[model samples]
Target: MSRLITIDNGGTLTDVCVIDGQQVAYTKTLTTPHDLSRCLFDGLERVSHEVGDARSLPALLRTTDYIRYSTTQGTNALVQRVGPRLGLLVDDPRILEDLAREEETADLYAALVGSRSAVLDLGVDDETLEGELVTVCNRLAAEGASRFVISVGGPDGAVAERRIRDLLLAIFPRQLLGAVPLLFSNELIGGDDDVRRTWSSLLNAFLHPAMERFLFNAESRLREHRTRNPLLVFRNDGASSRVAKSAAIKTYSSGPRGGVEGTRALARHYGLDEVLMVDVGGTTTDLAMVRDGAVDIDWFGTVAGVTTSLPLARITSHGIGGSSVFHVTDGVLGVGPRSVGAAPGPACFGLGGTQATITDVLLLTGVLDSSTYLGGTFRLDVDRSAAAVRATIADPLGIDLPEALTRMQDTYAARMAEVLRTEAGPATTIAAFGGAGPMSICAAARRAGVPNVVIPRSAAVFSAFGIGFSDIGQTYRTAAGDRPDDAAVTAAIEELLAHAERDMFAENIAIADCELTWAVVDAAGATTPLGGRDDAARALKAGGRVQLQVVAVLPHPRLEDPVAISHTAFESSGTRAVADATGTRSEVPVVDLARQEHGAEGHGPLVVEGPFFTMFVPDGWTVAVSGSGDLLLTDIPGSSKEND
Candidate 1:
């Protein structure tokens, strides 16, 4: 049987999902930031055992059809601002010369370039310019700036940019040892907006070195395993591309994009068009909207408040997750923008962590079972969790342990509710997933006034599952002027299509099997499909100016769908004391979903345990197991339930 594998390298965990024809296996391992490949291979080895394959990289690689990977490392780097020091080389010295003359403008320019960046002026003198370029490169190198961005202004910037690129190549000579990497603005972005182009180049240059190190290392490991199919990397554009063709800027928040794609698939299965997708991972919670059965794409995406021209799936990310640090600040409790990552993890993990986190709160409150966490692979320490909470939150506030726990849950639910209220429209269904999604979803949904919540069986590694579902695709775009003639528009579109075709050919995708589609965005921001018709170009003149986008999609081979789950009977494993919103403890039924049959229905005050996650059903809620093994949670009528 042909098999497909996907791995999502998250902030706190490396999730692996393997699909072998009709069977599927999922697992997670602690992410090793010091060396991510270690955790990646570790997770793969464990998953291979579940699929009944030899526990060796080469064996699994030879048997699997393809592997797709997604990661949040780029987003983390941008948010933390902890990348290589950068240097800016501007082709036009006039701009810098003018800014230097004005103190206020110079300060503003410095702020824009950041404190760690060194900006240099490239004058018109060819001899002096080459010398100046080398001198500045050495100077920036001395100051610890190993990566450089060369941006040129004016209409002829591309030509001047190429000259600077050639000069840098001659000086640095990439073949030489300790050679620094240089990025050019015109190659990454096509536009007259000098500011946007410069920012894009700077961001790309900052993220390039680390991304290259990890991705290329991972690729080399795969090659050692005799993997023939290319290792596809997920992009923020909701598609997968070869590692060589991917840009680091396009990979920001790419892990969350996979969740968005899975949400779309779920929407299709359930026949719901409008839904609110919430993905609660260890480090962040990502929210997005699917209206009319389609996910929205941000044509002009933004990273760290800086505008970029890369097309990305529109997802709202908040610093709330399972590993979010919880602290009492000035007698006020707050959840995080800070996380106790995989090294120490949550206090409940008992790996030398002292910080109280959301995970600790969940364990202390009995939302997670100590013995059954990660299906008994990783045991949790409830006592450690309680002690951390007592020290960090309870004692600081002079409140009892139960009250402090309740307060933590309340604050977390309130924050999630606020985000939902701000981002989601009224009367939207919520589809929640991720390792932490099921635990907090009920409370967050009730607070957000969402009536229905669906947590799929593959919720823990849902993002990795989504990566397996994505198509191999690439998009090319070019800027067009106002009222351009048909010939100009035609030529531009042809150029983009040709580029896409060439890229696809390199990836071994044939022209006939691939699908080509085109769209034009006018100056007024209205997009009209070209539909392979040249007549559509006439509409561009009416809208002022336009830009053409051409896309080529090569869909992955379809595998067998998930095996249907049969409902035989409902069996309770045991009873556990779970705390409620009021901090009162009561015996709650713990049901094993694997033992339950299709159409199995149950009441609330219970824990529906799965291999990867656990769902807490409150007193007034009801749940049913679908034929596909999906757990559906709903509120019962005439029953009052307090938010947890």
Candidate 2:
């Protein structure tokens, strides 16, 4: 059987999903922040065992046809403002003066230039410019700036940037000892927006070293196993590229990019045109919108409240999740922007944690089965959950245990509902996933005014599954002048395609295995697909300035067959007592989804257990098991099916 392995290295946990032909297996383990590779290998071992392979790490790696990896390390690094110290080299002195005139821009400029940076008035004589450049580089290096970003402002920005790069190369050659790395703004982004381009280049430079270290380390391990396929890393641009070709900034929130892809696939399967994807992870809750069967793409993504011109999926992430810390300040309960993380985890994990978290609240509210959590591999501490709730919430508000848990969940659900309502329209369908999604999805959807909700069987490791469904691809774009002739537009497109071809060739993807497509964006921000070179040229000749984007889709081993539900039944495991959102206790039938046959149907007030997730199907809803092991939940009383 051919095997495909994909791993998502999240903040609180590392999820591993393996697809071996028609069979699938998944496992989750705590993220080892000190060394992510440890958790990666650990989860791999567990997944291998679940597949009944029992092979060694290198042995399993050798047999795996392709491995796709995604991580949240860069996202976390940006959030925490932790990375290599950087220095900025600006060609124009007026740009710094302009930035300093405004408070907001001044703060952003400070962040971009960092504490150790130098500005050069390169318009001066070449002798003076060269002397200043050397002095600035030496001073910044002395001040501990290991990474440098060179951005030149004004009309001659590109020419000046290249000149600065060349000068730096001469001073610090690749073989030179202790040579610092420098990034040129024009090389990463071709747009004329100097500020945005500078920020993009700076972000990329900051994230490069750490991402390179971890990914290369992982790739080396795979190479030692004699794997033939190069490791592919998922990018936020909805494509996968080899480690050498990928930019670190492109990988931010890439795990959720997978979820968006999975959402698109599911939308196609169900024939739905619009859906809202809600991915709840341990550290954050990410939300994205899909309309008219297309996922939204933000060509200029906002990172850390700063706008960057990076082609990324439009995803809004809130600091609320299973591991989000819960606190009562001034007798007011508040959910978190702070997380307890995987080290201590939530109070229920019994790992010496004392802080109350959303996970602890879920356990106290009966949504999570203490004994069957993580497939019963690790047991949760009920006493700890109750105590944490009492200490952090109940005692502060002079409320009881149940009331405290109820308030916390209500607050969190209300917040999530508000985010959804603000970001999505009433006609959109809600698809929720992640380890903590199902427990809170029903309440959040109800509060947000959404009626339909669908939870896939692989909800816990949904992002990793999305990684499995990715295509190896890359996108390139170049500016096309206004009212250009067909020949000009055609030449621009060919140039972008040529760049993509060169990149793919370096990645070992042949031209025959690739498909090329093009789109042209007019001056007013309207995009039209190019039918052919003539069509593109004609449109450009007729219209205003345009931007040509070319995408090259390359071949990769993917999971093409429909996932099948196992025939095993859950009657032997029996039922269990669980509580609904209303705080009413009821004995619900506990069904092991792995044992359920295809086309099985059930009603609410039941517990549907999958490999790594637990779903609390409430009353007034009907659940159907698809042939592909997906849990389709539909509202029975107030549901309305809308056409695309």
Off-target runs (Cα >4 Å) in candidate 1 are: 53-55, 76-148, 152-182, 325-334, 337-339, 393-399, 480-490, 523-527, 533-569
The TM-score between candidate 1 and the true structure equals 0.85
Q: Over the full model, what C-alpha lDDT does candidate 2 score relative to the true structure? A: 0.75
lDDT at residue 518 of model 2 (Cα atoms)? 55
State how far residue 396 of model 2 sits from its true place (Å).
4.6
With a 3 Å backbone cut-off (N, CA, C), the pairs that clash in candidate 1 are 567-597, 567-598, 568-597
Q: What are the per-residue Cα lDDT tens digits for candidate 2 across 1-644?
A: 56889889987788898887546788888899889889988998887777674777677778887888999898888776678888888866665565445576567556555567667887786667778888888898898888888888654465687777767666565675246877888667753466777778888988887689989998898787788688889888777878998988988888899888877777776667788888987778888888777888776777666667675678888888878988888878888879887768899999988999877877777767798898898899999999988988899899888778778878888777777786765567888898778766766776676767878778888888877767777765455444555566676557666777788798787755776565566432345677755665565566532344333443332323343334333342467766554555667788788887666677766778887788777676666667567777766655432111
Cα displacement (angstroms), candidate 1, residue 432, comes to: 1.6
RMSD of 2: 4.3
Q: Tens digit of lDDT per residue, candidate 1, span 128-156?
A: 77888777777777877667777777655
Error of 2 at 571 (Å): 5.5
For residue 343, give model 2's deviation from the true position in Å: 4.2
lDDT of each: 0.74, 0.75
**Each prediction's Cα RMSD?**
4.4, 4.3
